[model samples]
Structure formats: structure tokens, C-alpha cells
Target: MNLSLEITGLTKSYADSGFMLDNVSLAIPSGTIMGFVGENGAGKTTTIKSILNTVQIDSGTIRLLGKEMTDRDTALREDIGVVLDSANFSAILTPGKLAKVMRGIYRQWDQELYVRLTDKFALPMNRKIKEFSRGMTMKLAIAAAMSHHPKLLILDEATSGLDPITREEILEVFLEFVEDEHHAILMSSHITSDLEKIADYITFIHQGKIILTAMKDELIYDYGVARCTSDQFRRIAEGDRLAYRVKEHQTDVLVKDRRGFGQQYSGIMVDQVSIDEILLLLVKGEN
Candidate 1:
């Protein structure tokens, strides 16, 4: 399978914070939307910085579109569109003026596409970026990112600061972008619901480590939460337990093969797990 982005042992650290990214590794396949998820300060931003060459890593390798990433890979960068949490444009420049600046920077910048997206997102073209609301700023950033016709899009909290309706509109545009089969996205967001809606695969990180990387369907359908009494929980095989938490009189165990466990333990209640629940269980539960 063709990979849009690949990272192996991508390690980075600072003197004060210790390890920010510890042996981090993941892959984004072509035409796939990979949800990069984690709690705050879980190294998601660090990993992204490593991939973008914004931060020098202490160790490991990063490959973008099959080529090893380098500090001076401007050619490779042109094919990758990025939208970080904050807008990175001059506050005085309007969207119209920013488009002209982008046209000079990106060889493949599409002015028409930029205009359409700005209009679709209801971003005002007449006002300076400083005067725009947080949502409008984010929309402008996304519009600029898409106008470049990038093969791979990297979005860090791109849907943040938007109303539900606007978020849905942006999500639709993202879904349409990946329909071309040549495009891929690596979106990092705190919004699990957004990821659940459109991500093909989910890679969850915690405390500078990857907890899980699996298909969205497999995560939702194959894995489950088995609620059982403490006695019943003790009877379960150690290998079948992914994570567990003790309640008042019961224990909720996360199992990888829910159906198999269900067949084996008919008395235990195997409940469907949502991405949010899975994340909570994994982060808070014990193995």
C-alpha cells in the first residue's frame, strides 16, 4: 500500500520537559483519513513538528510521500498542505491579499479555488485577518491550504473554534477532497466525534506513546466493553483483557475480540464501545 506519511522511532525531547515524542511511529495511507488523537500535551503537536521539520528530532526518521524528509525539501513541501491551530499570516492582510501572496509562493496555487472556498466558508474578503473571528481565521487557513492542490493535507485542530454547522460544512469538504483517491489527510483533533464521523483509521497517542492504531470499523465493531462482576472479571483470561476499570460492584474490561469473548463468556454483558469510551477506558483503566 502506498503511504502518504510514515514515521519510525521519531524521538524528540527538551531539557525541561523530558521526552516529548518517544519512539513515535505511524503511517497514513493514500486516500485515507487518519485521525491523530490524544489528550493535551500527549506529544501530538511534537510529532507533527517533527514531520514538518519545524523541530529537530533527537533520533528517528520521517518519510513524506515515500521520500525521506529533509530540512530543505521545498519540493516535497509544496505537495503537502498544512493548517495548524493558529493562523500564520500577517494580521494586516485580507484573504484577497493573502491569496496573491500565496500565488507567488506556491507554484500550483489556485486562485479560483481559494475564492470558492472562502465564499463557501463565508469568510469576509474585505476585512483584514486581524478583524476576523477565530472561526473565520481558521476557515481562511483551510481555504489557503486547499488552494495549493496538495497531495497530503496535515491539519492540527482544524475544526476547532467553529460552530457545529460550519464544522459540518468543513467536514463535507474534507470528505470530498479525499474522494479523489490521490489525496490523504492526517488530522489531529480533540473532537472525537469529528474523527468518528470521517476517519478511516484512528491512531491514538498518550504520554508520548502510541496506544493504538487500527481501522475505525474494527475499533468500533471488533472491540467491546465487557461489564462483569469482580468475580466474573477474575475468571476472564489475562490475554483477553486490553484495559479494565472497577466500578461499584462491577468491572468494565476492554476486550479486543468482543464477539469471541461474547461467545466464550455468555453471561458477561458485552456492550458496544464508542471512540470516546475507548479512549477514556484506555487512558483511565488498568491493563
Candidate 2:
């Protein structure tokens, strides 16, 4: 399989906070949607910035589509489409003017696709972006990003500001983009519900460390949250378990392998945990 991105031993640090990422390594195969999950300060955005060369890394290497990207190879950026929290647009320029500007910047810019997506997303072409609502700006950003038919997409909190309906719409656009199996996406968001639906793989980072990386479906099904009385909770052996919480008479345990435990603890009830729940449990500390 073609790899869209390969990052190895990635490390970054801030003043007095130690490394934002320590010995972090990840590979996103081409055409796969990789959901980057972390708490506010857990280096999700830091990793994205590092991949885009927007931030300087203390150590490690990142390769995009098998090409080693460096500060000198700015031209290589053409293959990447990035959408962050805000749109990279002159607030004064209308969407039509913005499209014209992009035409000069990207060699493969598709005015037809841009116009089609903008219309499909109902983005006002004549309105100044400054006057557009946050949702509209995001729609425009996505349209601009996809217009060039980039091979790789990097999104940081791109869906955080959207309503459910709009979020679903944007997700559909991502799905269609990767349908050709040559496009890939690296999406960083606290909104795991969106990731749960569309992401093919999940990478979780916490406290500057990679807690888990695996297939999204396996994450949901292989790991589970089991509930039992406080008395029953003492029955299971604990070592390398993911998470657990206590509430009065009941205890909930998040286990990595549910099949063996489920059969052993037939009296306990096991249920699938959402990405949000898994993140919450991880942030609270290793359980």
C-alpha cells in the first residue's frame, strides 16, 4: 500500500513544558482517514504543524507520499491541502477573487471543481469572507482545499465549529475525495463523533506519548467498557488495562481485549465505548 505520510521519532518541545511529542512515530497509508485524538495540550495540533513544517521540530523526520519534505522544498507543498481552525483568506476578498488568486498559486487548481463545490455547499461567491459566518468560512476553506485535487489533506479542528448537519456534509465530501483510493486525510479534532463515522484508523496521543494506534473498528469492538458491582470489580486481574472508573456501587472497566474477559466475567456487562469516551478515560490517566 502507498503511504501518504511517515513520521518517525518526532519530538517537539515548548518552554518549561518538556516535549510536546516524544519519540512519536506514525504512518498514514494512502487513502486512509487517520483521526488524530488528544486533549487540548496533548500535541494533536503540534504534530499536524510539524507534519506541515509550520513548526520546527527538535528531532525526527517526516516524509509525505514517499518524498522527503523539507523547508527548501516548498514546491512539494502543492500535493498537500491543509485546513486549519481558520481559513487562509484575505477577509476583504470575495470568493471569486480568492479563486482567481489561488489559480496563480496552484498549478493544478481546478476552477470548475471550486465553483461546483462552493455551489454545492451553498457558499456565497460574491460575499466577503469577513462577512461570512464561521460555518460559511469553513465551507469555503474546504472547497478551496479540495479544488486542487490534492493527494493528501491535513485538517486541524476543521469540524469543531460546524453544526451537525454541516459536519455531516463536510464528512461526505471527505468520503468522496478518498473514494478513488489515491487521496488520504489526517484529521485532528476533539469531535470524535465525526471521526468515529469516517476515520479508517485512529491515533491517540496523551501527555506527549502515543497511547494507542489502530484500526477504528477494532478500537470500538476490541476494546470495551465493562460494568459490574464494586464487589465484582475485584475479580478481574489488572495489568495494562486502558481505563476504569468507580461510581458508588458500580465500577466501569475499559479493557483492551474484551473477548477473553467477557467470557471470564459473564456476570459483568460489556458495551462498546465511543472514541470520545476512550479519550476521556485516557486523559484522566492510565487505568
Task: Please provide, for model 1 over 113-212, each residue's C-alpha lDDT reduced to its tens digit, 9 standing for 90 to 100.
Answer: 9999999988888899999988889889999999999999999999987888878988998999999788999999989889999999999899999999
lDDT of 2 by residue, 116-146 (tens): 9999999888999999988889889999999
- The TM-scores, one per candidate, come to 0.97, 0.95
State which candidate has the highest lDDT.
1
lDDT for model 1, please.
0.91
Which ranges in model 2 have alpha carbons more than 4 Å from their true place? 16-19
Judge candidate 2 against the unseen true structure and give its global Cα lDDT, from 0 to 1: 0.88
| lDDT, residue 43, candidate 1 | 87
Provide C-alpha RMSD values for all models, in order: 1.1, 1.6
